[model samples]
Target: MTLRRLHSLQQWLKEKDVAYAFIQGKANLFYLTGFRCEPHERLVSLLVFQDNEPCLIAPNMETSLICQSGWNYPIIGYSDSEDPWRLISTHLSSLEIVGSNLAVEKELLSVARAEQIKALSPELALLNCEDTIMKLRLIKNDKEIAILKEAAKLADFGVEVGVHALNTGRTEMEILAMIEYELKRKGIREMSFGTLVLSGEQSANPHGKPKMKSIEKGELVLFDLGVVLEGYCSDITRTVAFGNISTEQEKIYETVLTAQEATLSLCRKGTVLGDLDRKARSIITDAGYGAYFPHRIGHGLGVEVHELPSLNENNQDQLQVGMTFTIEPGIYVPKVGGVRIEDDVLITEDGYECLTHYPKELLVVKP
Candidate 1:
C-alpha cells in the first residue's frame, strides 16, 4: 500500500518536472512515508528527485528508528551538530543538475527554513509546491477511508461516555476529563484535538474552553470532540439540553438541527457543494435566526480536523465519492446560550453515509 502511494507521488513529481522536492510537514511526511513521530525537535524530510527513488533524511539518532518503521525506503541520517543542508546540497550537486527545478511546500515550510534551503542550493529554482500537495491530498483512497471510519467510530463512543457523565453538579472540566479518559479506554492512542465541552452560559461563546463552573439548570450542554485512530482523525459535536429547555433555546436547537439535516441531505455524488451550505443558511434565515449562524455550514474532515472542499458561499466543487467532511450548523446568541449539531459524513457513489451515531435529541439531564 505504501509503495503504491510512493509511485503515485513519483508520478506527480515527474509530471511537474520537479528534479527535487522537499517534503517536511508532518502530514506530508506521514502521507508519503508512514513515519509518525512523537513531538520533538527533529527535522524530518523526504527529498524526492526526478528518478523516483528518493532519500529520507533525518537526524542521526532517529535514523534507525525511522528506517525500520515499515517505510521500506533508503534513509540517510545526519548528526544534529552537522549541517544537514550541506549533505543535502552535496547530494543535489552530485545527483541532479545545479539549475534543476526544486519545489518546496510554501504553506508548510517556515520562511527561515526555506531561506536555509535556498542557501544550500543557490542555483536551484525554488517554487511553492503547495498546489501539488493539496491536489494529492484532496481525494482519499481505500486505505485512508478505512482509517477515517475507525476514527469516527471511536470518537462517537467517547462522546457517548461523556454524555452519560453530564449532570447539574458536574464541573465542565470534570466532564472534559471523563471524555479524555473514555477516549483512552476505547483504545484511542490520543485525542485528535482537546475536547470542547461547554455548559450553560459558556456555550454562548462560540469557542469557549471548558471551565470549573458547574453546569447549571436549563442550559445547553455541548460536546465537541474527536479521536485519532490508526493515524486518521474524526470530529463530531452533539448538543443536549440539561434540565428544562426554554422556548428560545428549543427553537435554536431545532433550527440548527434542521439546517444540519438539510445540509447532509444534499450530500451525494454530483451534488453542488455550495448549495448544501446555502440550504443550511436558508433554514436559519427562514427561522429568523440567520445572523446567528456565523460560520460556514461545514468543512472537509480527514487527516486534519479541517481539510478541503469547504461548504461555504463561494465553493463550486461537486461532492465526490470517498470524500468525508463535517456538517455542523450552529446558532450562537450571546448571553442567551448556543446550540449546534454536527456529524461526520462520507460521500458515496449513490448518496452519503452518516458516520456519527451519537443521539441528537434534546435530552434534559436533570440537576
Candidate 2:
C-alpha cells in the first residue's frame, strides 16, 4: 500500500517537473511509508524522488522500528550529536539531487527548516506540495474504509463506556479517565485527540476541557472523542441528559439531531460538500438557534481527526465516493448547556453509509 502511494506521489512529482518531495508531517510519513512515529523535537522525514527510490530519515533509535514497519527503502538515522539538516544536505549531494526543485509541505515545514533546506542548494526552488498530498489522501480505498469501520466501532465502544460511567457525582475528568483506561485495556495506545467529557454549561464552550466539576442532573453530558487505530482515526460526539432535562434542553437536542440527519441525508456522490452544511445551518437558523451553531458542520476524517474537505457553507467541493468525514451539527447556548450529534459518514457510489452505529436519540441517563 505504501509503495503504491509512493508511486502515485512520484508520478505527481514528475508531472509537475519537481525533482524531490520532502515529506515531514508524521501523518504524511505514515501514509507513504507505513512507519508511524512521534519524533517530538527530533527530525523525521521521507524524501521521495521522481526517478530514484525514496529514503527515510529519522532518529537513530527508531531506525529498527522503521524497518519493522515494512519500509524497505534506504534510511538515514541521525544521533543527537549530529545536525540532521547538515546530514540531509550531504546525503542530497551524494544522491546528486542538489540544485533541483524540491516539493515540501509548506504548512508542515517551519521557517527554520525551510531555510536549512534552502541552504542545501541555492538553486533549489521550494514548492508547496500540500495540495497534491491532500488530493491524494482525500479518497479512501477499500482497505482504508475497512480499517476506518473498525475504528468507528471502537469509537462507539468508547461512547458506551462513557455513558455507562456517567453518574450524578462523577467528575468530568473521572469519566474521561475511565473511557481512556478502558480503551487502553482494549489495546488502543492513543486517542485521535483528547477525550472530552464536558457536562452542563461547560459543554456550551464547544471545545471545553473536562474539569473536576461533578456532572449533575438536569444537565447534558457530551462525549466528543475518537480513537486512533491502525494509523487511521474515528471521531464521534454524542450528548445525553443526566436525568430529566428541561423542555428547552429537549428542544435543543432534537433540533441538533434533526440538523445532523438532514445534513447526512445529502452525503452522496455528486452532492456539493458545502450544501450539507448549508442544509443543517438552514434548519438551525429556521429553528431560531442559528447563532448558537458556531463552527463548521464537520470535517474530513481519516489519517487525522481533522483532514480535508471541510464541511462549511462556503466550500463548493463536491462529495466523491470513498470519502469519509464527520457530520456533526451542534447547538451551544451558554448556561443552558449544549447538544451535538456527530457521526462518521462514508460517501458511497449510490448513497452514503453511517459508519458509527451508536444511538443518536436523546438518552436521559438516571442519576
Error of 1 at 34 (Å): 1.0
Question: Model 1 TM-score?
Answer: 0.95
Model 2: per-residue Cα lDDT over 166-185, one tens digit each: 98789999999999999999
- lDDT, candidate 1, residue 204? 74
Q: Best-fitting candidate, measured by lDDT?
A: 2
What TM-score does model 2 achieve against the real structure? 0.98
lDDT of 2: 0.92
lDDT of each: 0.80, 0.92
Candidate 2 residue-pair clash tally: 0
Residue-level error in angstroms, candidate 1, position 45? 0.9
The whole-model C-alpha lDDT of candidate 1 against the native structure comes to 0.80
Query: Which segments of model 1 are wrong by more than 4 Å?
Result: 97-99
